[model samples]
Target: MDVGDLLGGNAWSYVGGTLLVLWALVWLYRDGLQVDAVADKYVLVTGCDSGFGNLLCKNLDVRGFHVLAACLTEKGADDLRMAAGPRLKTVLLDVSSRDSVQKALEWTTKEVGEAGLWGVVNNAGRSLPMGPSEWMKVEDFHSTLDVNMNGVIAVTMSFLPLIKKARGRIVNVASVLGRVAANGGGYCISKFAVEAFSDCLRRDIHYFGINVSIIEPGFFKTAVTSLEPLEKELQRLWEQLSPEVQASYGDKYLDKYIKVQRLIMNAICDTDISKVTGCMEHALTAAHPRARYSPGWDAKLLWIPLSYMPSCVVDMGLKLVLPRPSKSV
Candidate 1:
């Protein structure tokens, strides 16, 4: 067949096949380029009190990297210390506070000294009041943004000099919501900001030999995904709403909202959080780390594609799934 004939017949199939092959080759190449001397490296992880941060600290520590695990509570720090090796040190850090971040920076500097920091995992985040945007107050948005967005920027900026000196990695834990905006409230907005910030930081810091990676994970059954706290918060928000707003939404609407939230959480949240921490590991250790990593199957197959679809289509899909308010027009 001539080139024109081939292009006219099964062209899309050929293109798909070619792209798949290229992707496989790139994956193989990436797998082959991992850094050695892991024992000599130092990796600092934030929010190691639980979830991805806690697991990642233990994982990297086992692999021989000196891990500085930062937690918000002394209990959390002690728990991590007991769970991890002696090489794994725990520091109390509240990413939302400048004083806390600065203290942690000084501690890390003292620990690593002239060797510099090899990696910093900005895994501290919170997801709360994730109902319709109209249900949330301004403070609710600020609560999530303070931890997930501003915290990331503060910690990353504080440690950039050390990471640059070591020519190291910065892995920021965002979410599938960041790409797709599937949920409402500040969680998605903060994560979206994280993606933007990470992209800009990557480009700006590449000259310093610093690699920046953003981890976009799908629904994971971490504390952040717990339905109980969300349900409680929803109840609180409902109670706090003005009489007019409450009358419009009605108790039935609130009940349906909570039910749907619980259903979605149970159905989609992956219990095996290792899928996420594993990506963080690769971002820290790989010689040619990718700019973005989507760990969960749902993230790669579902939400990422949804994120790229037309806005109207996404809106319609969401509308179909969301519970209609009593006075919805």
Candidate 2:
């Protein structure tokens, strides 16, 4: 039907319009449901031995994605390989080390041809809540950057050529902390860098049909925020502190902080990670994927607003939530 005829002058115009829209949807859905866009395509996912990375590798493999799972240790590699089955290959990659990164690139290129690689998911990262910024050691902060920020870049660069060739996706596992920072630590800064990098990559690669998306999760029962060592260190610090400092902000303050941490951990543990997995699948599979995905309820309700607020507002809000320091010795 002609455009003018369909506009209002034709008898069957309504029926033609309906049929055209249906046909377009059918065409789009034809290729969209296969979330494993890299099915039979080489995909390298970092930190595949545990947590989100492990789950993603398994999920992708089940959906027919050929996964080159990168683990840090032999035991981790062995476990991943055992669970991943035939389609999943294991490689020991320490993303923080240049030598390890180069080795992984060489091995990946040789094992799966440069043209065969489809996607790279930078899923390995650590979170260290090292008390206040002033209290934390420089090494604590620097090492955090070494792994979270530097490591992601190293892996991304290693596989960029292959990803470009395939016109594939890059899924970066940044945190809600990346977007909002009430909690001051090295981890937050590293995640912020990751988010920035991912955004830059998405813009730069838009013309090339390559997608770069960041997953900003609030808390997902990951090992990054384990409280065991935290508790121990806090106790040790309490013992070492001078009486004046102890009297000024007594055990009550520390107790409150620990309580908050516990509450957060509990909330994270209760979250259903399937929500995140679903988001990851969408990023890899959707014809028109979003630039960023927030995978948890807390991420949406809490961090999203915090992310947009001014620094002073965020600081005030954080102070309100944090338990007041105790004055009793």
Each prediction's Cα lDDT score? Answer: 0.92, 0.80
**TM-score quality measure for candidate 1:** 0.93
- Best-performing candidate as measured by lDDT: 1
Using TM-score as the measure, the top candidate is 1
Q: Which lDDT tens digits does candidate 1 get at residues 1-329?
A: 79988777788888889999999998899776999999989999999999999999999989999999999999999999999899999899999999999999999999998889999999998898787777788999999999999999999999998998899999999999998887778999999999999999999989989999999999999999888898998888888888999888876998898888888888888999999998999999889998999988789888999999999999999888888888878
Cα miss at 169, model 1 (Å)?
A: 0.3
For candidate 2, write residues 1-329 as lDDT tens digits: 87876666565777888899999998677646654435557778898767888888889899887888999889989988888679889999998999999999989888777565777889887776456554455776887799899999999977888888888889998988888775655888999999999989899888988989899987776666678976775565566567787677765777787788888687655346777777877788777777899988888888887778888998898887777666522
Q: lDDT for model 2, please.
A: 0.80
